[model samples]
Target: MKLLSSEIKNKVLESMVKIIDRERHNIIKANKKDLDAFNREDQALFDRLVVNEAKVDGMIKAIEEVRVQNDPVGNVISDLTLDSGLKITNKTAPFGTILIIYESRPDVTIEAAVLAFKANNKILLKGGKEAINSNLILEQCWHEALVENGLSKDWIKLLHLKREETQEFLRNPSEPLDLIVPRGGERLIKFVKDHASCAVLISGRGNNFLYVAQDANWEKTLKVILNAKTDKISGCNALDKVLINKNIPNYEAKLKELQHVLRRANVNILVDENIGNILSSENKIQEEDTWYEEFLALKIVLAEVSSLDEAVEKINTYSGGHSAAILTEDKNKAAQFMEQVDSAAVYHNASTRFTDGGQMGVGAELAISTDKLHHRGPLGLKQLVTNKYYVFGDGHVRV
Candidate 1:
């Protein structure tokens, strides 16, 4: 975290206080196309992006949330006493500027609103091509709100342009980027990690594993499988691989039934050697890439294995250290599965798709913490913070 002088910090606070009051519904009256400073292809690409109105409204509310005496950092967090006649206290502080690059999801724009506001930091958001239009509309709304509050509208930046701009922001090697977080696929994450000038936190990738128990319930298994694969195939947290223990009777039939549900949805299903079936374009599983890929479409990799141990071995080998799920009625087996799978989240009986910040009960999320340190799993408000300590004493000097 870059330490800030008290004057600059107060200026930022004053700016935020001014911006917050002006940003509500200022740009809602205009068409999203009005902010066409960028290209049309950008808007066309983002036109297909999926964002709920309620989610947009939530972003609108988040700006106001900062002014509502909310926990927007700098709050008194701790106070303590020591026997050496010392009084100690701890408080929160901002992490300076935050730059977040993510795949096309308008929801993230809303997330950025709450995140930058609550964290008391300036922010730049560069969304994926899929969310250009949605993002533009949002930026316009935000600009109007900020201007309404008597603040510079540029405090929140929306870098809407080519992919090159994203790299340019990351490649500022000499000037420096305090922190760079990439919230897209492995490819984008790798690109940012390789090129970023600042410390990179692998916000994580969404690849999960699920293994069936020896005596799994067929109906429940099918339901769980459907929800995991089809719930939101485009999300990083979607389940990617499934293992069926060979010890389970009629494993093939159960797997096939699950395949039937997927195939009916036109989802691409890939198979490996354990499937005991040949691969073709008919949704039959094949190719090792299936395990490593997050299709963001209706697709999954199907594999069969001998035991929970084998399932664990496969996941540890291929998982992106994201989330995984398992379905079984046996307590010991669930415990073992949970113990062995090295994922950010290990689900029992629930869909691997539910391994999300929103589903975990947080009102909102910045991104999935695919990284092991700093932030992991669902990234809520708590993850946006760090604590600092202060101590006081009367004429006490250390020897």
Candidate 2:
């Protein structure tokens, strides 16, 4: 793929912002078709699929934000004149073509494509069939933006492949795929990893954990818990597991109080044996596999940990390596926990919900990557590009 000038890329995004604003009505109408055909049983997914007036406004804002961000490509990372007089520089470069496989969330069609285009990468969106109509309309907007800027429509594409065809395509891509981001559950990540010949970035799992240290402020604990758990059940940054230190003062009373609060909020509780013994009415985690699951719903698991070490160990062992939080008044303990916790984003005295790109000041995001090889955490415009080494050598022969 040829490098696109920053002005050209921004022009496309500018066109996209205007086009999306003008076609807001059409976008919503197409989204309505999807919503009408969709089963609302999966409340989280249904929430993600809906494109209301607010969502349309959000899409326009995303493009506008990406347009203002500096171009990520060609930024020099390191420059040096070697001993042999060879001047070498490592600079950021676009990742040629990227394929993102996501479910629900028609907003991704706007966010992901905008980031990739801004960074000069060709994007191939593989959204779930549930959002076909919504995605098609969004793709049309992208094509129009490209054409309006006199760029090829090939810069952005939405794939309409079935399960079998997708698997085959991953195994044998019709065109080169520089990177593939699987932005859904573990099943989707595994599917891409197992079949895709290119680099695969794991994303969108929310088996996130929050630890309530013994020294934590009880009021703050309850507030963070409620916000992280119920604020946005469909978000990948939403909390799913809570580890309460058993040594906390008035531990038994706190456990009962927490249970009451969650019940009041209508969040289903799944307790481990220790907590189950205390919260007798709540359901026990019957399967160990439940620990590894990302509950993207109004559900949470409450478990008791004897010590901070135990909590850290459990989080690292079972979490999706996305985000983890510790509530502690002791800064030293908080720092220790943050250092030991193995996750993309670690919080101290804060909710895991702050792991979001926009909230964390990264503006619009393509995905919250859980992979460590290339990037971890929010896949923002700056994080979307790879690096290339440019070497300029004299005509002298090697020693």
lDDT of each: 0.67, 0.93
Error of 1 at 258 (Å): 2.2
Q: Which stretches of candidate 2 lie over 4 Å from their true place?
A: none
Q: Which ten residues in a row have the lowest lDDT in candidate 2?
A: 390-399
lDDT of 2 by residue, 273-390 (tens): 9989999999999999999998889999999998999999999999989999999999999999999999999999889999878999999998898878788889899999999999
**What C-alpha lDDT, on a 0 to 100 scale, does residue 220 get in candidate 1?**
88
Scored by TM-score, the top model is 2
Cα displacement (angstroms), candidate 2, residue 71, comes to 0.6
Cα error of candidate 2 at position 125, Å: 1.3
Q: What is the TM-score of each candidate against the true structure?
A: 0.81, 0.98
